[model samples]
Target: MDANTISHILLPIDFSESSLNAFETGVAIAQKNNASVTIIHVQDNTFEYDHTNLHGNHKIEDNFGDVLNALADAAQLKLGKVPRLIMGEGPITASIVNTANKYSCDLIVMGAHGASGYRELFIGTNTYKVIKYASCPVLIIPTKKKFKQFNNVLFPLKPLPGVLKKYDLIRCMTSNNQETSLEILCLSSKINDDDEQLFEYLLDEFKERTEGVPTKVSSQYSFGNNIAEIILKTAEELRSDLLLLTPSIDISNKQFFIGPYTQRILHHSKTPVLVIKRNN
Candidate 1:
């Protein structure tokens, strides 16, 4: 994104090491962009018999408030501004999204792992739900991956209908780093004369749009089943700092599923992922 593309950032914290790491990364971005920050904590306490109690909620609020205060103090030292922290009942996903919209947060930075820990994101938790429903883009910091200036970005584009539109989002994601080099992996299941022509045109189009940036566009043909594997491997091989993703588009048909491609990438990517869910 451009320096001003993000004016307000929303962070959802559960106090996991992963979430805390996300906190650090979010502040770093805010410092870079001169953006405002908001922290949200969702309380999921429900004892079916009695759900509403001020005392119980107060205890939980204190617990989250202590950590948030410490975090805000440190971040303020760097940002010269204090971040707003909002706490409410959960239904985690809905709370996070609603808080973001209510505060006019343009970007959400969150951790990839959930209760399952480092290896996987429970489909029902933080990153998945937030990306699925949030109005703005979500940046996911993977477990154990340190945040760095994005010098190289791995953008995997499948040659399905409407997939090329994702390139515009990639452009915005990398606009902040003029020195960033983008490696576009054009994946296709079946090769044809038309597809070959499309690849050539796509390469030219990508290069032209990235005027001051260094970019490389390559084609991986006849690779349908292993698209996710291919993308992860390339990002590793290139030592990419960020992996830009849109929802998966099935090449064989008109429908798409998040289970296969996007899930695999989120589950196993060593690089940070920026998920841009377009309204189309």
Candidate 2:
């Protein structure tokens, strides 16, 4: 999916501070890309209790609808004309995925915290699930991360077959501005003569595809046993504004199972992670 062609962005909010921060970030990105934003709040259906004898199901359902309307109205007022509001029901991750598909959103932006409770919707278990299952890319902003122009992006490259096509999507993120820069870190457990040749070949192809994009692109090789550690370290060292990753997953059983390295980067990276889900 080309992010540069983004016509709509999906922002899911829980009314928490982190979600608000995410909303602000999404607005900034929307403004930059000239993309319309759709803000959604998912009310968990599991929390709905059996009101057969109490207030009656209709009364309870009406109350829930009223609450959602109020929330949508408040969000629309706060966001101005840049966003359209949506109210969704069901499990948090499923609701978010469904809404994104319904809206044909090219990107999903949300805030994630490292703690549990209400904050868990974004950063806790839900965050991983969204990244794994979402049809589009998910941009995760940490609670403490403030919105800034993404000048430098750190991308970690794993030499898996058919993985090079993913670089085209990265161009979409930076295509809006010529000042954006990209640094690719190609990591391997060992570097031999053949490995160096292959790395150079891949790098050349990457540079070829990314040419004429106006952004500065550079690459380096790192010998490492721990891919996640190397990626995080390099990202921090470069002071990257965004971390781009195409997470490795196994879907043979029709279930999303994240790779260990991808999970670690999602949970530990301080910078915003732009998770580009690989097509099946």
Candidate 3:
């Protein structure tokens, strides 16, 4: 998807500190790109309610609506501008994905952790599901991280066919800001002649595509067997504000799936990681 064409950004809020941070980051990006923000709060519908007591059921439903409205109002107030608020009820991950697709969101910005810590919404369950299933790009912000200038963006590159398509979204991301520099961190376990040749080819293609773009584009190679570790180290060394990753595909099963390395980066990266879904 074209970054310039990002008209809507989806932000799922659980009212946690991390969710709030993600909301702010979403708003920041929205304002910068003149995009609208859609705030959604997914209410889990798994809780059982007694159908025997009609009055009690009505009261519960009313309370749920009231709570949703209050949360929406709070989000709007904090956002400083009116945003489209959606109240979703069902499984959390499914609700988020459905809402995003329903709204035709171009991007999803969410927190990496919720009130229940890493094992909750962002890190363990919902976040992973969204990244794996969502058709659009997902930007995950850590709880402690704040909205900052994207001066440096670290993009981890793999020598796979049609990998250049992943960078198209990056162009959109950095289009408005001329100061944003994209650092391409190429990783390889062995620094052989073939690896160097592949790196050069990828770099050339990148340069060709991003020729007229104002953002400074550069490439670096890291010799490491562990792709995740190399990516994290490079990001930290550069003080990268954003990390871009195209998840590895596992074709071992009947259907392709997100690889474990992507999960590792998502769980460990201190900086916000923009996970671009591969064209499978």
Candidate 3 lDDT over 130-172, as tens digits, reads 8878878898988767874466888887677767777776655
- Model 1 C-alpha lDDT per residue in residues 66-119, reported as the tens digit of each score: 767777888888889888878777688889888888887878988886433434
Tell me how candidate 2 scores on lDDT.
0.70
lDDT of each: 0.69, 0.70, 0.73
Candidate 2 lDDT tens digits, 29-119? 6665667778777767666433232234443345545644554565455446536777767788898998888888888888775223544
Full candidate order by lDDT, most accurate first: 3, 2, 1
Against the correct fold, how does model 2 do in TM-score? 0.79
The lDDT, on a scale of 0 to 1, for candidate 1 is 0.69
Which candidate, 1 or 3, would have the higher TM-score against the true structure?
A: 3
Cα-based lDDT at residue 227, candidate 1 = 75
Q: Is candidate 1 or candidate 3 better by lDDT?
A: 3
TM-score of every candidate relative to the true structure: 0.79, 0.79, 0.81
Q: Residue 150, candidate 1: how far off, in angstroms?
A: 1.5
Q: Model 2 misses residue 268 by how many Å?
A: 0.8
- The numbered model that scores best in lDDT is 3
Give, for candidate 2, the lowest lDDT window spanning 10 residues.
Answer: 48-57
Clashes of each: 1, 0, 0
Please list the residue runs of candidate 3 whose C-alpha ends up more than 4 Å from where it truly belongs after superposition: 1-4, 45-82, 119-122, 175-178, 248-256
Checking candidate 1 for backbone clashes, the offending pairs are 1-173
